[model samples]
Target: MEVTQANILETLPQDMIVEILSRVGQNSSDQLLILKSVCKSFLKLSEDPLVLKRLSLDRWRLSPWGNPKLIYLFNLCTVFGNPNAIFCLGLIGYFDTKYTDLGLDFLKRASNSQLKEAVYVYGVIIFASHQIEAKHVGLQILNETFPPVPELVVAVRIKVFDLMRQLWLFNRHPFDDVAMPCPISDHDGYFPQFHGFEIAIPECMSCFWAYELDVFANRFAYN
Candidate 1:
């Protein structure tokens, strides 16, 4: 039998094919989508939950939102236990007030996975939204001690500095007018929330910071 590209891909193990396809998806969405037309094996590999999860991460890593197709992929990833994708979906929820409640829950699950970026982003949004729960969660994140890893130490210090800069540059400060409230539960009470404005400096800074954390997570897991 001739060792053609199709033959070679078919000969590789499913795990190897998935990893290769995932890497392709990460580097180039256009190329990754093109692979769906390559062959049945490649098509199947592209549709795997794991691959879709990674694709979703790469799709929305730079921006807070994407087209409907990426959102569909993210929804699938959330079902497949991709915490980072969950966080992304939650972050996207910020685009519309109607979705903020659901977004908050998604962020909560992602943070519980010990994703530091999720924790920080979630805390910032809730705090900015002025939810009372932010008080407790904020205290936990500020106080929670992680082992002395130099990278995390550096990330945390940078995070604090960014937070201060954001506070100073943006009017995320308290306002006399109360924000529209989305009640989480019967027992929960509402507070004045921050209204939506343009995707401001604070969000961009938080996004860059989250990307930094993502780099750390990838390094620890894959490198």
Candidate 2:
């Protein structure tokens, strides 16, 4: 009967309530949990597919061996097509378990969602497969992040490098044995001449991107 925040929220339309909840916990699952505990209405609406899809598990460490409750939460998010959840599950499945195909499928899904990190890693993985058609598709995927301009390419490289670093910090093993797209033999005779010195530039765009992937993969590779 008294005016309260819960009362006000309850009076709002369901779409409005869902929109508000979607923004409530964009970065922290803990916030969502607390939100769900606030009221019965909140609890029921918190699991709405729209809310779940936008929820971020950023504050949570992703691990198959992690807390079962958290894992369940991740599963819920994944079911609703949360890109980050799909990426996390893909990494765990691809690296920690024997379900590599399933993991790749999830990664592809995440990539299709335009999650930049997913796009970068999935492209690199596919490129490293060494099959000609896969390499072409992979290169096309990688090219989506990198524009033709040199400056833009550098910017994407740095952004992707930072993303890879964050992933390595949380999920190291999966990145450990990633195959390099460019072999050592291909590296020779590809360097361009610059200021009377040999530069690391490759002869082709494909190799150049391959070099970028190799550098990133090696930079994060476990010792």
Candidate 3:
């Protein structure tokens, strides 16, 4: 009976293999982090930017309750050299808390991989986030960041934009948008508010259509 290494690998149980991968991800070396962090020429944020990165992080979302032991388990993909699992989860919109920035971080790390879907979704998030930012920092920069929401996500983005505008009008600062939370429900979902300054504008429809056109024009916009 001539056994080969291939046979041994094949014979290993799937769960066992997964466990091994999980361990590797948890114990990822400092060198690997540096190698990944520097992959993109300008991805690394300045030290101050790194502080901004952690400013609003919800640690519980990463590893809930008191069990921080699985923290690396969530980061296993990084250690195992596959960011797709993390990317796929982001697309499904599960990272509601810190999902947007977290996705971007993983993205900057895996810039070499074909991540069209992830990129598109990231655009959606960046648009919303930057829209909120525009309220305070100045519409010009936010305009550049959020721009037009992708067509498919247009309807939602318009609502986001309107709320953002309201936030800006009322709160009056970029960081204030984040500091203040809007009790936003779908204005378009029910009877339209035809009165008041917050009334839905036809321009929002423009934003929506822009997104649709963008999706169709580019064979791949942000699906």
Candidate 4:
């Protein structure tokens, strides 16, 4: 009897195989690729919509969009009803001024699913838009009523507060709209520099203090 990788994978429960693939997709993209190349069963599992959804969300959090792999997977998984993939696709559109309306439509679908990240980003996109109606609608999404699920309230509040804090920090920056370099053009660099200062400031301040202390000590020392 000839044995094969597919045969071994086929012996496991389908959901169990999917769970393993999902975890692999979440943790290591390289390993997932290797697995996918090993056998038909592994490849199929790797392409599972749920696994792809997790991979897309991780990529969205870690990397800039429009990567071919992300776009392909996102488009395919979206057809399978992956709300996160839909949200990410909408985000790509929202970030581009020309597609703002289209982006809003995708975001609206994801928001209806109560995907917290989608809701928060949708609000940001709308608020940043030039259209008056968009701004009003975005604000409403940001401040949407807490759901009746008691267990979700705390998490939802934290996400909202985090977004609000980021917005507050953004508004506090000294530059006006015209003077500011467009963040959208360099979203990866600029967004974190300005909005993520809560985390960055502490680390940066410590380094600054260390440098200052060294300079002062050197200046005071006698030759």
The candidate that achieves the highest TM-score relative to the unseen native structure = 2
Ranked by TM-score, top first: 2, 1, 4, 3
> Whose TM-score is higher: candidate 2's or candidate 4's?
2
Query: 208, model 2: CA deviation in Å?
Result: 4.0
Best by lDDT: 2
Model 1 regions lying over 4 Å from their true place: 23-31, 34-38, 61-71, 114-116, 125-136, 142-223
| Worst lDDT 10-window in candidate 3 | 51-60
Predicted candidate 3 versus true structure: per-residue lDDT over 61-99, tens digit per residue: 422225554444334433444444444334222233334
Query: Which clashing pairs does model 4 show?
Result: none
Looking at candidate 1, the ten consecutive residues that score lowest on lDDT are 167-176
The per-residue C-alpha lDDT of model 2 at residue 90 equals 78
Backbone clashes, each candidate: 0, 0, 5, 0
Displacement of the residue 205 alpha carbon in candidate 2, Å? 5.0
Measure candidate 1: CA RMSD: 13.2
Q: Over the stretch 1-106, how does candidate 1's per-residue lDDT look in tens digits? A: 6667877778889998899887787676678889877788998888787676566353344233456776666567678777777766555553333566786788
Model 1, TM vs. native: 0.50
The per-residue C-alpha lDDT of model 2 at residue 173 equals 48
Compared with the true structure, all predictions reach lDDT values of 0.54, 0.70, 0.35, 0.54
Q: Which stretches of candidate 4 lie over 4 Å from their true place?
A: 1-7, 26-28, 60-71, 113-116, 125-223
How well does candidate 3 score on lDDT at residue 84? Answer: 45
